[model samples]
Target: MTGDHEPLPPGGRELPALDGGLPLIGHGIPFFRDPVGFLARVHSSRGEAVAFSLPGRRMASFCGPQANALILGLQDDTEVDRHLFYDPLLAPLLGPGVGLTAPSELMKWQHSLLLPLLRRDALTRHIPVMFDEVERYVAPWDGHGTFDLLAVMRDLSARIAACCLIGPRFGRTMGPALPRLLGRLEAALFAFAVIGPRGPLPHGLADRARETLVHAIKEIAPRDCPEGSERSHFEELMRATGPGGSSLDEDTAAALMVNWLFAAVPTTALAAWTGVLVLQHPQWLPVLRAEQEAAFADYPPTTLSALHKLERLSHCLLEAERLHPPIVVLPRPAARDLNIHGYRVPRGYVVCASPGLSHRLTSVFRRPEAFDPDRYLPDRAEHRTTPQALIGFGGGRHPCLGATLAQQTIKVIWSALLRAFDFELADPEVREARTTVMRLPRRPCTVRYRRRKR
Candidate 1:
């Protein structure tokens, strides 16, 4: 409704729905109640693409690596339109021809504008920003203390995201409020996807949150760095132009920043879960510490090169991401008719894939559910076999834009934690990660820590 995409012609074969459902409402109630659990059950039974039991909508749920590749790649092309799915939920937030809700050409343009921030050398320098954030974050845990790892990591992730992505000055001045504001908008995509656009949503709350961030974004005065000086991703977006040198409007630019921060805040799930998993598997601490010592000896832990040398720690982070992916289901709309995995998928039907489900396939992962970082190691590299095998950060051409930043943030935080203190779980209970928004621990992952004697 928000974008200028064409309407679907009402003449396509209906996809088969998942079993066990009420009469009229179908499986809407259960699907809304737990999107990930419902999808897991669906993935278990269905071969590739299976329809969810919701009555009004026709969504084809795809599982496994092949399915993930098919949908994530095909959904944005000729037959499928990415905007049709995103615009309903996100149009109100990102607007037309901007970021996720934009058409292919426009989306690519906006992406190109943002790409300068992720340049190789630029990302290398960002490690210190993350390290500094983590250093200040865990400083309060003096001699001994107990705290919720998830909560602590979320706050720390927000600070790093603000400082590194938004701008160092703005992050310091206005960083504290980004989490609460951005949190309101985090669930909009999936909530709207499952419940439908007309379904119950805190429209007023999200609107207010978006406006507050936009207001803050607009406050910063534009500065000229002359020629080759550095600029934050926020500043880059603020000055960047779109098609034919046409500058993005103020709200559009703010929407782009909002999108970036959205990825940073709640999706800090990776950094948070990485800490939780390492704590849960205390056996790996020595291995991580040894690698840390070696890495730091060569190039101080503050540098990006040092973090890159932490291959084992990085693998653990990847394993944690594999086990607890940020988002459960990725769904997109078909603008025109297409065939998916031998099924005749009609135009307007939504096609979806679950990173949570796909990542846990026994065929794909050895000891799928366990914290086995060696799965990514050279000897038993299970994830390397398939194209979209490890889809925690998406696959095909639409991989997560912030995947590198998320990984760097995790590295910096964990390296700092491992070096500065000794941590032990307050409650030695290991909670399994679930398929849901953020995919972090619902219950408290509390831990006790003491300042390490250097």
Candidate 2:
């Protein structure tokens, strides 16, 4: 019998295995039932690092500080080939571009080109467009009525993302149809991932959507570019000169936009959870509303300088991000065989970290389950205590480049909403959004809003 402290044999290390599963499916049932809870239980009972199986795949799960640092610290010998996990699904919709599936070198280049567009200065310039889009979307919801939270937010976020990323030309050209089409494409991609590409739904839905989007962008991209100046987000991306001064072809450029949609669309939509959770807490409503009013009284949130002063709002959004992380799980493949917390992680083995689970650790959060934005306050800053504890926008090598844009978009949307109306959950029965890849507030969840008397 092997003792707990005994030296293990080659290729044989101690890895706690999660029990209770039916034949063939392994832990699939329990995992699908409640992924966040299942992972939390694994960390509590089996330790921070453990192993689990799903159908034909062998996988490892990591949690707590040590595991968090290992996976998100950007130093581990782990690499991501998203196509390995999402190829059958995402590749067709997002395209085989650098954003979807790229080697380290190409990914680095893509980040370099894209990051500048999403930086503070550039993002500030786009704030007006974002704010205008949010105002347009929410203008209708002012009167008293219960609106589907996820659907409304999805449409709101889609308009904001489209305005900022795709430019006003394509945005104006497509109008509301853009968001609806993109939503359809996004749904198709998720379905493909779970149920195979050829599974159930009609073929070419995504292909058609992508064609429409690409065709519109290709037409407007040139006109949106200044005749001689290197301005506009789309212009910068189009002018991105690769190694040896080479530029992206039409197809590749379109593919990058598709990939950016994958990153920007869902994350922005999921950020609406901030509103869902915040409205549920009446204690924070007045506080948030007061802060938003005062902040925008003298200075419009259409600039980053003014937006940065909304500390309470920032805390609320950060807390919401911690609770409802857009991308719930990050999976990495071991670049080579290595020992991770006594487990022999073979090359190509899948190791995943769930920010959703990590955010709820009692050791890291005072009251992990409760929503306390003040936990991010200067004095009690829990996230500051650990490097990887607050992974709202992910971390490590492939951290979200559109993070600043996503946050600013959320801030603008919420600021506009809080200023215009008072709202609460219509159903009052909160539920986690059922999503295969991303984490979002569930639909059928409605918010009743009434226009505030000035």
Which lDDT value does model 1 have at 131?
76
RMSD of each: 4.5, 4.2
lDDT of each: 0.72, 0.71
Q: Where does model 1 exceed 4 Å of error?
A: 1-15, 22-25, 75-77, 94-96, 187-194, 199-201, 221-235, 298-302, 430-436
Q: Candidate 1: global Cα-lDDT?
A: 0.72
Model 2 Cα lDDT, one tens digit per residue, 82-129: 555655656677665556466556766876876766877678777778
- Candidate 1: residue 69 lDDT (0-100): 71
TM-scores vs. true structure, each candidate: 0.89, 0.89
Clashes of each: 0, 0
TM-score of 1: 0.89
The best candidate by lDDT is: 1
Worst 10 residues of 1 by lDDT: 1-10
